[model samples]
Target: MTAVNSSDEIAPSRMLHRLTVLIVCLVWPLIWVGGLVTTYDAGMSVPDWPGTYGYNLFLYPYKTWLFGPFDLFIEHGHRLLGAVVGFVAIGIVIAAFWKENRRWVRWLCVALLLMVIAQGALGGVRVVLSDRTLAMVHGCFGPAFFAICVILAVVTGRRWRQDSDAERLRSSTSILTPTKKLAALAISLVVLSYVQLLLGAMMRHVQPTTSAGHFAGIVSTHILTAFFLWAMTGLVWLRLRRCGDLTLSRPGGILIFLVAVQIALGIGTWVVNYGWPSFMTWVPGSQSFLVQAKGFVDSMIVTGHVATGSLILAVSAMLCVRLFHRRWQAKQDRLVAT
Candidate 1:
């Protein structure tokens, strides 16, 4: 196998790379929660952007912090977390610029960093303009940014760049056209997940208050898109299972399981609570069976759903990267043998 060597002086797989990946993965969930904080109209709970109560970020007033209300604090905390994510993104991008093997990979990281900055600005715009449209667009971009980070992490991981020509030639000998097909299905599932995420952002922006036809349309569209996401995930899993590639197939199986649980929680929240509270929680202070069901559905459910989406996307991309690297190795081997 031809090693994927860098012309640059620095290498990416050092301890810093792993740390960066870990940080990005951890930040992804916070990004989604930030989206929710805005989607639920909680952005102005503190009546500020980028800061709270005239203090910068972490230095907000203690009284305001501990007041008889928690909405502002939640929003402020989201902003603070976003700032941390931004710093981590910048660091990772700079690391890529100096250390990555491939020139294209460096450029990709640069583009993603720029997008992150733009996303941060959009958050400010969403606040200053008080425009739901801007808020919705910002919310939608958050997941895309998170997905990019996930891709970066996957690329930096051990299994990503390490391809074996010997194994590839062996794999190729097994009539693994089915494996290629599974790779395609994995790519499709990732794309569909992004689409579903966008639809969800749109629904959040609409925040339908009444049982009007428009609200029902939004709800129906959201639910149906979710179903499509689930179906696409199933296709990914099925193709991977048939491919018989244990590495790719195993991760695909885990992703499918995550999707199943995510969909169940989604259904429970929507069908039982009509998607109230806008926070993925049960109706507050209610003891009814419906509220109880919603509460059970709420805790960890939304977080799990978003987190799982990011995970599935990361896993799918990793599988594809493996396939392409293996193909490159195989082609190289055949030339050497000839």
Candidate 2:
């Protein structure tokens, strides 16, 4: 909404920003592998928590896991990646506390550390109890954890750090430039998309427990949410684009692209899992299509759908933060000019 003032530039701890970026990079692949595990019903491959087949997770025989059954390889690899992310979470806080001048940012890093720990425990307990519901919960929390990492990555970077000492703008609708509406709309989209994600999880992990009628309701709701999320994302993109700020418009563009890809993937996921819908039966080649359960094409499509949903949330988080950052910096600049 406003040009970044060169005179306003401030340096942040390079190590903290680097660690934050590293975790953000690592978390997305972790989500993809987790999605794959779910796609193939490989949650129980290791049947142990914090370990692989009773061996220390890191010390587990590579020959067995690396060359083991496909499910075991993915499941164990997912655990290994999670462990690595957990360690990075610790490093993020240490770097933030040691070098970051902002007390609130340090606390955010601490919160990130705690969230990753809780998320890890959720995954482990889901394993020990063999609870699909907890598995879904774990799946749901991963995006939120990734979101915080994205937030950390954005805030710790030079763009945000440049305004390091400005008092936080009051959380109100007054700060949006050009229009006052983007703040609440962006925030709402974040929450709505997350709800859509939960409905998706219900379909993926809790379908067996749901009765036919109940499951149909969920499917209907999921479809409706996707339509609504698509429209909301479009609206946000337009607003961000019109703002004429590259930093803001770029994330908005990324969000819209992810949503478009996600919608196509969603369709592919539906077709591969359930065949053509009754409404599409009259279309060419639709009658010959058959649902392929766990087939390579179907698995990758479904897994991509899941991972893209997380990406949508992650980018949405970045845009929301950028919007707020712009508003906050604008307000600070006005105050200084006065």
Best by lDDT: 2
Q: Residue 291 deviation, candidate 2, in Å?
A: 2.6
Q: Over the full model, what C-alpha lDDT does candidate 1 score relative to the true structure?
A: 0.64
Residue 221 C-alpha lDDT in model 1: 79
lDDT of 1 at 337: 61
Instruction: For residues 1-338, write the lDDT of model 2, one tens digit per residue.
Output: 44355333447889999999999999999999999999989999888888777898899989988888999999999999999999999999889878887778889999999998999899999999999889999999999999999999988888776443444333333434635588888898889878978999988885565798998899899988898888888888888777766777787778778888988898888888888777778889999986655787778899999998988898888888878777767766666546
Q: What digit string (tens of lDDT, one per residue) describes model 1 on residues 1-338?
A: 34443332233556436756766766666765674575345777766666676688778776776673655756776777777777777777777766677677678778777887898899888887888788778766776676677667666665553444244456555534345666567677777777766666655567545457877686677778767767776777676666456766776777777677767766654544453434535656433334433332363465455555655565666666665555555555665565
Q: Which 10-residue span in candidate 2 carries the lowest summed lDDT?
A: 167-176
Which parts of model 2 are misplaced by more than 4 Å? Answer: 1-10, 162-178
Model 2 sits at a Cα RMSD from the real structure of 4.4
